[model samples]
Target: MAKSMSLLWGAGSPPCRRVMIVLEEKKLQGCKHKLLSFEKGEHKSQEVLDINPRGQFRRGVPSFKHGDLVVNESYAACFYLESQFKSQGNKLVPDSPAEQALMYQRMFEGLTLYEKLKAVIGYTWFVPEEERHDSALKRNKEALATELRLWEVLLVTFFPTVATLFRFGLSAERYPQLGGYNALLKDRPSIKASWPPHWLENLKGQDNLKDI
Candidate 1:
């Protein structure tokens, strides 16, 4: 019998989306997906706790359960999956030491920017306008823009293979290069298959990076 792999995830989560992209890329079979509801505190339930006791934000969503081995932390899970399943799908980590080092650098940089992106989203979308600190929001937006400019330079250097781990896009007028980057990879099978479901329904005018 094939081994079972259970993915506990929440929709619209970047970390969760990252794991889903890996699973899709590897084309894993006999895997089960369970969506958790934060509103209902499903993640805190005993069943989930058994699989992942940490359950903290960083180690929370995007957890992978295979037999008795449970892996949390999106990067840890992703690296383990990619290394273990190398024979199955496209090799996510490169073989050359220098290229691999560059890949890790990109991932770490993306994670740093992800925190800033989260701040932008929290301040813009989730927080009420009256409760927000406009000054802080402005600072975060500018910081995120700066990081994106760096990404544009890297994309030019790497030409399409850089930052394949994260899906970030922006409006053309605001970020022409990143916008073009989004367009370039919009149709990739992994991205297309793992595209956020809600975004698909309201695709016409939705800005993928409105918060930034």
Candidate 2:
């Protein structure tokens, strides 16, 4: 019999979203998805702890389970999926050594950018207004702005090669190239299908994360 995989995840998490994108890209036929709730503290529940005793939930949402094998962390899970399920749909990790290296580099940068973005989101939105640190929020926003500008610069010089790095939300005025790239990624079937439902509801009127 073919192996079955279980995926545990929280909604609206970028790491979870990343893994979902990979899962959709690979079109895993026997995977089961379980959505966790932050409001209900589902991540800290005994069920999750039973599957992953020492897993770092902060690092990623979607944890993968295939029989006795378990993988946590979005990057590790995505890479594992790409490596193990190659005979199916989209190839995420690339073939050539040079191309693979480039893809890895972009993925690494994108992950770093997401970390900063998460910090910004945490301070500005997730955290209670009374509990949020103004200084930390300011610093995180500044750092994110710097990284975004760097990506914009890269987009100008290496549009074709680095375009995939700008696959998420972006500002049109500050990052015209990345904005176009974001549109392309948003249009992707996998990305569209796996997009955070809550984000779509909340961000409907917003153009960018500049003010947030």
Q: Tell me the TM-score of model 1.
A: 0.79
RMSD of each: 4.2, 4.5
lDDT by residue (tens digit), candidate 2, 149-186: 88777662222122223323344666677777666667
Residues 24-125, model 1: lDDT tens digits = 778774568888876577777777778778765434577788776788787788888888888887778888999989888878777876677777655656
* Clash pairs for candidate 2: none
Give the C-alpha miss distance for residue 74 in model 1, angstroms: 0.7
**lDDT of model number 2:** 0.67
Which pairs of residues have clashing backbones in candidate 1?
none
lDDT for every model? 0.68, 0.67
Model 1 regions more than 4 Å off: 1-3, 54-59, 124-132, 156-169, 204-212
